[model samples]
Target chain A: MAEETKGFSKEEEEWIKAQRAREAERQKRLSRRGGDDKNAVNINSLMDIMVIMLVFLLKSYGDDPLKVVDEDLKVPRSTAQLEPVDATVVTVTRRAILVDDDEAVPIREGRVDPSQKGSGGQSSMRIIPLLDRLNDAVEQRRAEAQLLGEDFTPEATIIADQMTPHRLVLEVLYTATEAQLNQFRFAIIRSTTESVGGIAEATPEI
Target chain B: MARRSREEIGQPDDPDLAPFMNLVIILIPMLLLSVVFLEVAVINVTMPLGGSTTKDTDEPPDERLDLSIALAPNGFYITAAGYQRPPIEGCPTQGPTICLEDDSVDVAERFEEARRLLAAGQDADGESVMEEGLQAYNFRELYNMLSGFKEDFPDESTVRLAADPDIPFALTVRVMDVSRYRLTESSYDTNEAFWSAEFATETAEDGEEQFANLFGDPAFAVVQ
Candidate 1:
């Protein structure tokens, strides 16, 4: 019968030790090569440039969220012969009114009484609420200016639908004028003329 | 071989960049992915009025001129001879057999015709003609039209651009910019002999005096 033992000879042990030593030397050589490549490639500088580019792109993206609303209520056309100078714009449509193309305030069906339906079942336009909101926006702007100790000439530009009743358009205009925004601009379509200043101003009916 | 220096102990020649490269590769695409293109208003404006009033220009002796651009659904009408009430006579209708409740003449055609008329009025030839097709009024056409009007009516250049309420706002702004350009050239013209003398000689007191003296007042302005 052969005897079984968990022991190795001295020669076998020395051979195993030599194999381990060889592996360790190979590993050291590989590490040294990797270290030499680190300075040549300059990965940090490359990353710095990429990070700067990313930041630049982010800063330049001043996206306005207002244009994403119901495109069905797009602004109407006009050939008014005036240049639109620096002014804040408000757009009114059949379904809703947009403030600075950012917020859409829905036009609620006007009610005559708090609890009862309007007479003839026709709702009145909630113009007062719209006016109030506009006033609030103006006040907010004013407050911001006050905080900065700067005076700003506030001008409100109204872009209304052509199908809108004259009364409604007039009321909005009246509200804006009352709000002390004299420098108003009404958008219009392009004309044949290159210069806008030459076109005669539209006279007020009043 | 040189002995290992103690000062060089624990000094790594290369800094770790795997995390940073990972961040950059992800971030570069992320930032690029985040960019969005938008259309911003370069020129703002409003429209002018009295565009359809031809009676104001009826008196040739008054030297008043009227130009009207009538826009219908499929076509446009340009009547520059003198502003007369839109001739209600020849409204185009849908074909003989099939007439729809809302069917009417080509409003786009009328817009084109109006464009042609304006072009003709501005042209030295005074012949209104247009290229076939629904040409969206762009910046160039507006520039040509307004600049020509400015050159022709150096004294009083009033152009009435009447468009259907349904036209796009962006289109309107491009048109408005054309009108705005008219005043820019006037600065150079003020240095001309005729304008300088006219400015020097104007001292009218009454409305009639003002009317007589300001007969040549440049009236090109935008009204909506």
Candidate 2:
């Protein structure tokens, strides 16, 4: 019985032990390879989120004819339902007045600088710089229309801050009129309120 | 010989999404830069025709409403072609005509009281605040008066809106808003219409519901 239990010789026992060690090493290598595979980024879910966000952002971009991106400009809220038309934009920020994003005149203390006004100085309704820019814009539009064999419809859009004085607005409008841009549109944020027959509840009196 | 079993062939690799991921990542920031969150609309306005430009013609002159609304520092001065009435008590007149007064709220008196309180270094305490419920201009009253004019001259659509130099542009916009449309208690679900003849409901392009048109055409008039 003892001889049978110890039937394998030293060399045989050594071979068996070596075979077990080899199997363990092979298992370790397999596990290492599996861990490496796990490290590879599974970005499928991430791609899904990114694609959705991209679609949403693209839809919102460039949908409007005019974009009021200036931080200083706070357009008044109105119940007017008319959509904005494609026209020359005259922006009146707190610090300056811009025509087609070009600063035409500077404003000080919510009023146009006296030096920038035409003839009558501060009391004048005409703004020389703005009038010049508007005239050029009108002439360019006219030339473009003529080239396209279409009639020129002179129009402009006024995008003024809510706190802008009415005098400044009138001056801009008057300047545009002098430049032969008679049609005007005042840009405002569309208000969603039930008080349509009266002033909005959030409107400040003064 | 039998074809190789399915297990003998390795699974097909996933389509490379690296380029797509890069594209999406780049496009997101670019689009975000140009995205506009504010819903902007426009109020159409025109410069009032100057009196000096009246042309000589053989055609009989049409009777005009000549509706003008002047937003002065004190109050609104309204003038029309045929409408005339005595001015409110203690209200001032424009030349020979009795202009309308802002009778709804005494904004000037409220400001005076506020100034006094501030000078005395006192808090409002239980007293109503100066700006609360006290509008500088009586916009509701103005709307009512304009509605009356619309009733009288349904054909007249033009109104000359003038404003004081110091008036905020927001106030002018508010006036324009009130002048443009008259809101009724009508909804899409309601089959019945209140004052349907005057307050017709129309859906805007963006699916927003709107009320009937009032003096839809407003012209900017130079302050006299």
Candidate 3:
């Protein structure tokens, strides 16, 4: 064994043989103990952390009623305090208009496609495609409300990008109005700061 | 039977949690992906029931102030009870409308100055520039003007908000916001604490804080 240990001094070879012997002794001890000492990892602390993280994530997920997901759609910051409610969502991004996450109309250069407009093309306030989609949604919502024996209030939430042109917003509103959605809500990022300077206060006198 | 019992007693008490750990590993990433940290809220607005134009009624119009604000690309055109605001002498007019071009209340300039200070690593009046790209709308002046109107017509709550075709939707929302509330004080230390500090709020009978209203109800008008 000493001859087989090349490039190592006698003392170094002796150390290596001692290490091997210790390892073998430990292995023998493990085997005698029914091989149960295979580095049992303590994951109780890890499980506790994961459970806490899951609860937090779940809470945040359920808090928001509306999810504004488009990358091009940057919702404007405002001090409006009203909490968002579940309603028919009308999302107007820089590129397209979506009704309840379904693409209804295509927008280009901050203007609705002229062909999608009614009579006067880009000059027309009524967007034909958006009107059709909203009409369908209103009908469906009405039916659902009726089935549940509740009064149907035609409400829509408009999730528009901050850079969206007023023309596009008007067209969407007009289309929604035609579909009998009288109550319109503009979705905005809620902030308490006066940096934007629009603090909505309640007027009891009104 | 004796050997089996002995072997069972020697077994580890810890259950096999590998499957549960695997499940947690998968679930955490999926939930994290769908989680939204944004504080999203909504501003309620109503469309005129009879379209853009008001319907004719046999009864005479009440003393209620019919305030209409037209948001042009140049500036705001404010009209109340059929009286349009005439052009101010010193302020340079933007097109035909009476532009409120007060530099002291210019929101764009304040935003720019705040941004410059923040970029230079200096304090910006306790305000951090949260959003970029400010329009030239004089929101402070607008707020002051609306506050004055609220004083004159305390009972009036509705303001007709109409915007030119070229104006941005964000500007329209800003106009609605300024029209809705009256800021009692001018300055605040932090953005989060501003609402409680400056705004005129009173506690209701039920212990809820009641915000002082300016023009709380804003109706969208068609740009005809």
Candidate 4:
């Protein structure tokens, strides 16, 4: 057999050159069109999607706090959606009485102070202690209102434990009523549809 | 020419909305749910009933208005004192067939008897005994006894709650809600901490439909 030619014949060479040119042209066309879409980031669309997701996630959550009565009777949950509009709040806890941030008077369970002692072995409710604190706060608020020329009185809201003795609660109410804080509102947890008798009724006369 | 035609068609270069749509569908529901959740109110309000010691002498002594709901460690005893007459000899001791224990008569029966007596008194006048029918009891009995008052004293405005020391706070609240009032007292001294809650008025127009609104519609706290 004759030795194989190292180079192509004229016809073969022409075909090879034409094929190379065609491939180069195709490659050039592809490059001009733009490279593969690998790293392009659609930031505007991404931001839009992120914002939508953020808003949707926010909507799914309930801002209302889970009202649970803990062992420590602190921060009672209220169903009255109305904000505590009353500037003055008198919070009576098992521990003590709190009025704004002035101070707290520790109330002992089952036993009251000597000042509340009645003639009978029954001790009077220790409301005097609470009233004194409240009165002082009211007086301060009144003076402030006078200085600022604002309208203010002892219009206060009372927050007390549902279990607090009626006697004690009465004392607080009597004291408040005496202070001319007739307009009052109570904070309660709205749960099941069960009746909470007698104590919650607000009879202006009583 | 083909590329130019394709460009004129305005087809988006990329086609992927999986993440975008997924985010929108999930996010929209969550935000709506959260806002609805925020609006709900959770309140546990205990209302009060009408009964007073001081006003006993002022009102006509027709029916036994003093309802004592004695709560013992084991069970409870509801004693009605101000009725025109005692319950028709409860349980009929040694009458026809057998005898029953004094406490064996169901409190429900007692309440029925009390209702019958009030109804009979109203029939006597042939108008309405709205003014006469009144019950003053403690929590457990008060809750059970309220319907009777509602039926007989439908037009009567208030009932009193005279609770004993043994009543639990939860039970007391239940009774107050049934009576539809929060017992509060008037203070002689504004500085005084303690006061008494009493039945101050009675009227025909004031009517309470729902137990929730038993206290005032505003739901004020009462102290005695």
Taken over the whole model, the C-alpha lDDT of each candidate is 0.41, 0.68, 0.71, 0.42
TM-score of each: 0.45, 0.69, 0.74, 0.43
lDDT per residue (tens digit) for residues B1-224 in model 4? 11232323676545676687676667676565444322222232223322232233555554434433332222334333453222223323333111122243343333334334333443223111211111122233333344354344443433333343422233333333435532232212221111123233444346733222223222223334
Between the candidate structures 2 and 4, which one is better when assessed by TM-score? 2
Per-residue lDDT over B64-93 for candidate 2, one digit per residue giving the tens place of the 0 to 100 score: 566777775466677776454334444555
Query: What is the C-alpha DockQ of each candidate?
Result: 0.11, 0.44, 0.37, 0.11
Residue B125: error of model 4 in Å?
54
What docking tier does model 3 reach? acceptable
lDDT of 2 by residue, A1-206 (tens): 34643878787666566656766775687577574446666788898899889877766665666755455666767777789988888999877899988888888767888888888887888899899998888888899999999999999999997657777888888889889888899999886443322323444321
TM-score of chain A by itself in each prediction: 0.47, 0.71, 0.74, 0.50
Compose the digit string of candidate 4's lDDT tens values, residues A1-206: 11333355777666556656766775676577675334444466766866766765664453333322323232222223344354466666655556764434565652345554333334443355566777787898899999999888557666665444445555555556555565555554442221112224231110
Clashes of 3: 2
Candidate 3 vs. true structure, TM-score = 0.74
CA lDDT for candidate 4: 0.42
Q: Which candidate number maximizes lDDT?
A: 3
DockQ measured for candidate 3: 0.37
Which residue runs does candidate 4 get wrong by more than 4 Å? A1-71, A74-87, A101-103, A110-112, A115-122, A140-155, A194-206, B1-141, B165-168, B181-224
Q: Report lDDT (Cα) of residue A50, candidate 4.
A: 69
Q: What residue runs in model 2 are displaced by over 4 Å at the alpha carbon?
A: A1-41, A146-150, A193-206, B1-36, B49-63, B82-85, B88-134, B185-199, B202-210
lDDT of 2: 0.68
Global local distance difference test of model 1: 0.41
